[model samples]
Target: MRIGMIGCGVISQQYLASFDQLPDVQLVAVADLDPARAAAAAEGREGVRALSVDELIADPAVDTILNLTIPAAHADVDLRAIAAGKNVYSEKPFAVTTKEGAEVLVAALAAGVLVGSAPDTVLGTGTQTARAAIDEGLIGSPIAATATMVTPGHERWHPQPDFYYTPGGGPLLDMGPYYLHALVTLLGPVASVIGAASRTRDVRTIGSGPRAGESIPVSTDTHVTGVLVHESGVLSTLVMSFDAVATSAHPIEIHGTEGTLAVPDPNRFSGDVTVHRLGGEGWEPVPTAGGYEEAGRGIGLHDMAVRGPELRASGELGQHALEVMNAVLESAHSGARIEIASHVARPEAVALEDVRAAT
Candidate 1:
């Protein structure tokens, strides 16, 4: 899968670093709204070229478009790539809204191209280890879980934090996908959600970059709390916050009849996954039993290239996660339990192994 990477930004650096080791995928070209930025990305690379978005999409050597555009442009870029007969793999918060996300899927289906999404971090050992425990029946029958993410705000470090406060951005919409994706990966699809949300301030002062001390409008909820009722009857409680300074909570925890598993951050590639059983005195570590052992961001594209329709980090999963996040916000405003209209099968578990293709 030769790739044309779109968007040259902070997140793109991670994917750039990752592409070097993924044997099944190659970075053939790159593009961004800013031509200068695109050129800079291609500068030291021997075979990679910087092209306009239009040129990259039409480039015969580029069979896949790695979309790293902002949330608002995800669907548009995806639809464009699909139109040009290219497979697309996007960064998360798949799109600003479920309607937009769904449209990306529909177009891909009609175009006969594959669509994939990020937070492929879950395809690493951290969450996958937790999953292996569950599948091994160490956690017994799953019952409930909690996923938490908290921060004062992204303005403290991000050079450009304006997008994080707008409608398409928020604690739930921006940071929710990681936790939601992990939950779905562990528990299966959700059936409904009950939500409540709040915001601490109407304006935020950017703390870094050229825009330091500049105030940006906050149009979305800064803190969101919700209960996702998985179709399997596992209830996952979620608390995502931009208003909080810190917390002692684990990134996630799964409770079942026999034990409770402390899952590492789903946003990372690997961590110690531990479990405490019914009569245990302390938590014990679970060995890594799945995912790309030393993998990084672009590993999902590798997965897509090899797995075809069974791609784990699928566009359908991205859309389902987007719908779940949006439904929670709708429930927050309406004070009603919102039922999810779309359903996706839980992606097949990653086998415990290294990602290197067989020699």
Candidate 2:
């Protein structure tokens, strides 16, 4: 498949490299607000052209458009791609709000085009192995889960990280999707969300970097705490913050009647996944069967480029994640528990031998 990429930022480079390695995929064109940035990104790349966003979307050679713009621009880019009658693969948080996310979904459905988003970490072997273990009843019935993400705000290293402190870019919307998607994958659809959010600091100092000690005014919530009620009666407490110090807590920890599974950080697609039985003395590592040998940084985008439309995490699963994440933010804002309206069916099991063979 031939694809065009919008927003040639740092993450886009990873996508470009992975696409280069996939024999079936081709990077047809690239577009960015800055022509120089887009040209520089496309330079020395084989068989790719630099064009305006409209021109790239209109290109007959491109079958799909990868939306890599900032959080606020996601919906607009997706809507334009849908109007152009092209499949779209977007970055995480689908949109800033539930209403915007729903609109993107509606447009995709109406246009008969496929739409996928990032945080496809579930497609990685780490998550798939965990899923297999759960399906085998190794963990018994899941009862509760907890996810935490704490970091010193983003003004430290990102060349253009100012947007992260603004309205459409906070802990809940910025880093929540990874954990939320993992929750939905391991558990089921979230039935309701009760949350509280706050802006802990009016201004944050860049901790470490060349821009160290720089001050950035914060406009969005820096800390968020929520309880997510899944359809299976599993309660998940989610905590995300940009104002707190780091901790030893795993990104995700699920407690089942039989045992507790310690999942790797959701920010990464591959890592060591361990499980500890209720009475076990120590954690036992679960070995991965084979799939993508080297987990690409953007595993979701890589999988979509290489595996085509059949990839598990690229379709309804992504949409479901977006819906749940948006619901969480809405719950925090409205001071009411928000119920998710969208549903994603569980994916069918794939044979381990099949995955091994694919590699």
10 residues in a row with least lDDT, candidate 1? 350-359
The per-residue C-alpha lDDT of model 2 at residue 11 equals 83
Worst 10-residue lDDT window, candidate 2? 350-359
Each candidate's clash count: 0, 0
Model 1 agreement with the true structure over 196-307: per-residue lDDT tens digits: 9999899999999998999988999999999999999999999999999899988999999999999998889899999999999998988788878988888899999999
- Quote model 2's TM-score: 0.92
Error of 1 at 251 (Å): 0.5
Q: Which lDDT values do the candidates have, in the order given?
A: 0.92, 0.78
Among these predictions, the greatest TM-score belongs to 1
Off by over 4 Å in 1: 357-359
The residue pairs in collision within model 1 are none
